[model samples]
Target: MVGSGFQRLRKSPWEILSSAIFSSILVVSSQLALAMVPHFFPSFSLVSMLPIAGVVFVATVVIGRWCRRLLGVPASAPAFVLFNVFFLWGVYICIIRQAVPSLLDAILNAECALLLFGLYRIFSSDPGMVSYDSSRSTEASCNGFSDFSQCENSSLFPRVRYCTSCKTNIRGFDHHCPALGNCIGQKNHRLFMVLLTGFVIAESSYTMCSTRYITRFLNTSRVGLEANLSLNMVISTMLFSILQVLWQVVFLMWHLYCICFNIKTEEWINWRKYPEFQLNIPAPAQQGSAFSEIRFFNPYDKGFVGNIKEFLKPKH
Candidate 1:
């Protein structure tokens, strides 16, 4: 299923599992962490796991509802929590256990930090909202687009749209992202690309490091209660990383194509509604043809290089 917002991204089973794990870990004490238990002692992982799961489920539901009521940024908190969980686990569990080498770990952690920073920028930055002018309200009303900030002298902001979720008019509006709790628009679209690329890189590195560690552990160690518990957690992390990397990479490619074509995700979906895409350019004429056909054209297309340059240097 797509995420519960305008992102239109997949909600993989691994994502659900990660959210559950994060929620459970958050509600449960640090003592619930398998790492806290001494290796020499009898493992209490089995004993502690069930209660943690149950308590976390209840806590997650309550917290989710509370956040929705107060923040109005659906799924943002969970996504933030999941990112922190991965970083914490990578440092505390994977790095400490030598799953990743020092040099490689340093690079991976830097990428993780970059991803976090990009997400922060997306969440905090203005998305090129078109300021409403009461002076132009009469003109807007006359234009039959009073609800939007696009009328009369606002020919420059052709793709402007009123986001119901944000209660504002966004310039070059693409979509609302529940994960980042922000709208993807002219100002932050490039940042979104950077974030997506960083995510794919970081996730791929994490998956590789996790796979190396898991393989090494399984080959070298004997099966024991404590060992089994640790292995299970690592395995789960690897699985989540794999699933997320696969999904996000595909999403990244799709966005790249849109960028190349100078087409917003929203515009692509509702092309017929936009006058910019209504260029009825005629097809080639034939010698005995009774009629010529018109093909749809994107007026905003400035060729691939020009489109990329425009995206990188947006008019903000």
Candidate 2:
């Protein structure tokens, strides 16, 4: 499935050609900017980076636009502007300049590209929404019903709650991610965490591989720093990597916690908001098992390994 999806995404010859052209341009422009410090600039200044930034921006836009059109990922996959700046810095300092060993750089770039493709897959896949008429039935349609199987979206085994923002009874709706322009739900939450995990791995290795030079250049004397454009490049890239790693670690860990406990982000947030939500079980005598006033209780929570399996299971 993954291979076929990637093939479909890259089926366009024009897209492949355009991406190759922009990637080549990115490599050349970044290398030229990095080379400026060694030969052209004895004391490079911030003002000198304007030309480099302009060139990188053009290349980024071209590639970013192509990715958006092909993969349905946002033009800026990450909404954070800092990520983009750091990406450019990373390219200029390490990737284009070949800061790491040739073989190591190739390996890292390949891994990073695969992680990026994974993100595109998660973003583009439909996340268990029942929008079509054929997929929904009157009997299966849940109107905030207690028995989740009654919902058309059986992918959401338990959750079928009204989403005030979306104005629909969403099944297992975790939350809407504006960055991806999609809802992270029962079907895609696992994929979302996997994507986050991939970024964590990619960023960690990238940082580890380049940390030595980045730190050395950052610690250089002011005059030496000015003479070495890589110093600025490395510093910015390091900062960006650090920020991303920290954020991804915390974010992924939190989601892991949620998965372990068999809870959704949306439920965790509003669990306390409604202490005594009514459950319609169609029988007042069977209230204890079917519907109870068990505050903050997550019915989906199995055991530790059990919940983990639930999370790892293939999304419907």
Candidate 3:
């Protein structure tokens, strides 16, 4: 069942072609920009790279739109390409240009590789998909609540949700990540967290390194800095890195909080719907009220240490 579901996730020919085209443009454009830097700037200022970057950006946008509208490629796939583009630019223009220590460069590259691997694993691995078992009655699957059988999605087991996007029931369902092009659930949740944490660290470091580069090498004079394209390019990278770091950090923190309490994001958002939550919370509950005196009771929460243990424990 998992295999069949995974097979469904496979990309169409058009999608593969679209990805190849997108990647090719990014690689060729960046390399062309780098090549032009030596001849145009002589001293190799980042200013020379901007024109190509703009062109590449426009080209990718057009291709993305065309692919989505015509070939029907998933919009989320472009995010992976965008990430690589940023990482490549950061490494080449900032770290290399600034001549950061080899140790730092190696570390950054290693993190990038690991992040790519983690993403691949998340994309390819099953996220604890729950297969339908006709032999098991709704009473058994729904914890003796046969009434739940009347529900449209009665086949789902406890804590399992039907993902419309993936067309499968995800066990310990968290949320569907369009960017990852997969559902995050029991199996891949750990990998998702690791990837998020790594990206937050890597992007933050990239921002720092780029800032250091601008400060160290660029002219400090007000006039010199004013309208400086090279400075602008580096600054743009810094801003991009900062933006990524900000969102990822916030997202990571939220996930960490949920993990500490042994709750899934889906459950956190839709707690009232679950009988466990309704039973735990006192009577006369205001529906969908954000503020309540009664603390949410999570049956799965086994204290901080225990929750962490549960999260980290290997899954079969």
Candidate that would win on lDDT: 3
1-316 per-residue lDDT for model 1 (tens digits): 2222232234578665655555444434322342233232334443344344344444555765575457433244535544554644554354334866788878877877776667667767787776644554545553766435345544545788767677667788998776676788988888888888887787778767767776787679758876666665554444445555667888999999999999888778867666656666444565556555544668889999999898888465
The local lDDT score (0 to 100) that residue 91 gets in candidate 3 is 48
Off by over 4 Å in 1: 1-97, 136-156, 280-295
Report the CA-based lDDT of candidate 1 relative to the real structure: 0.63
Mark the 10 consecutive residues where model 3 has the least summed lDDT: 1-10
Q: If ranked by TM-score, best first, what sequence of candidates would result?
A: 3, 1, 2
Flag regions of model 3 displaced more than 4 Å. Answer: 1-8, 19-74, 78-98, 134-156, 219-230, 280-296
lDDT of 2 by residue, 37-145 (tens): 3244435553464445445545655665665567543233333332343464356444334446667677777767777676667757656654423233433565544
Candidate 3 residues 252-312, lDDT tens each? 9899999999999888887766656544343455576655354556778799999999999
Candidate 3 clash pair list: none
Q: Which candidate is the best by TM-score?
A: 3
Candidate 1 structure, TM-score to reference: 0.69
User: C-alpha displacement of 173 in model 1, angstroms?
Assistant: 1.4
How many angstroms is residue 174 displaced in model 1 relative to the true structure, after the best TM-score fit? 1.5
Residue 43 displacement in candidate 2 (angstroms) = 17
All predictions: root-mean-square deviation over Cα? 9.9, 9.9, 7.5
